[model samples]
Target: MKIVIAGGSGFIGGKLVDLLVKNGHEVIILTRSKKTPSKNVSYILWLQEGAVPENELHKVDAFINLAGVSINDGRWTPKHQQQIYNSRMTATDELVRIISAMEVKPSVLINASAIGIYPASYNTVFTEKSAEIASDFLAQTVKDWELKANHVTQFGVRTVFTRFGVVLGREGGALPLMALPYKLFVGGKVGGGKQWVSWVHVEDVVRAIYFALQNDQLQGPVNVTAPTPVTMEEFGKMIGSVLKRPHWLPVPSFAMKLALGRKSKLVLEGQHVLPKVLMANEFIFNFPELKLALEDLL
Candidate 1:
């Protein structure tokens, strides 16, 4: 299989590219910058305004879209919010446009989404089947993002929305930052510590994408989180224990809100998202428990 990946240079996307290449699949990365091509992996610059290169847009086996700005990168100002929206919607809408134009459409289109689409609640467990979309900025952003990606299905393509949680890993994504405070011995719970932190190891994140691509029955939104969800306090404790540090400090919600504004809710509030679709499809997880996930990543 030859796969085209947007945002293939990022943390999780890099891992996914390595996995696909190792599995003997040719990978083409759709990047925003110019880059030299490797043996099996090639690059194509995306302008998002004009048609993608005609030759590269033909007969692709799978198109994995992961283009988006990090919501946690800065405070969610109106400008930053628009950046996030354009980053996701523009990239997705462009892919849909290109793929729709191709005479031979890709078999699968696995697009990225987030569990933040679900309303934040300490008790409610959200699955892909959940109908309650949060009206918050993050949720509305994801809602529109998914709406754009789902449009590809109308063109006879199988589209899968991999709604992610906090992706934990050794090198990148949120784990290193989350573990840094623990390593420095100042790690503790954020907010009230009751907010659920649904997370998955990066290894599973890569594998889950492969699983979704191979399984034809798997369509629609699939939660790419571990089945076992932990609270923010529990997550902190797990990180502390894994790093051999004491979890004593507590980050107040007011302070985070003051510092990060609406972005603070990413740490202060969360939902217990379960991988109902993934598990039902018989997809096995490498790290389902938070402790094991922290141990491997830390």
Candidate 2:
């Protein structure tokens, strides 16, 4: 299939592009760079409110939108927060509008979302069917992001909102930053270490996206996390064990809050999310367990 991917140069998206290319699928990346395209993969420059290449989007097999600002880039100042919200909303809205104008619309529109849509709780395990929406900045941002992507359904296209968790890989996302302290012998649990972290291997994340594209019944919000959800304490232990480091020292809640401000929730708080939709559909995860996932990446 010929797939058009927005933000395909990103960490997870880059891996997905390689996987897609290896699997004999053509990839057209919607990037902001002027980098030359490689074999079976191409690029199209895109910006907010700019002209879209309708010719490239015409009759595409699928449109996978992963464009968004990183929530962990810096402290969540008012301006930073607006950038986070605007980046996702603008990209998704533009995609939906472009796809709507297509003569032969893509069969599927897979939009990247986050599990932040659910309120942070140690006990509650959230699934795709969960109707509860958290009343917070991250939750509302994700809710609005998904709502914008859902607009494609009006044009008879199947829509997918893959709510990602902490995507762990060797190079990018949360693992490297989290592992730095462990390597320096200062690594430990954040806050009280009771917050539940819903995580997944980068490979499994890519697989889930492909699975959603193939499965006709998979629509709406689908959690793209590992089946096993671990607490911050357990997760720290897993990292330490894998890296052969000690996991004892802890970062206090006040220190975290002072450092991250509102973004402290990214580490000090979390949601126990399960890929119930993927499990029901029999989507096998390459690294379902945290220990092995850490070993593979670390």
Clashes of each: 0, 0
- What lDDT tens digits, residue by residue, belong to model 2 across residues 69-101? 888688899999999999999888778877877
lDDT of 1 by residue, 195-235 (tens): 99898999999999999999999999999999999898998
TM-score per model over all chains = 0.96, 0.97
Q: Which segments of model 1 are wrong by more than 4 Å?
A: 48-51
Clash pairs, candidate 1, are none
RMSD of each: 1.4, 1.2
Model 1 backbone overlap count? 0
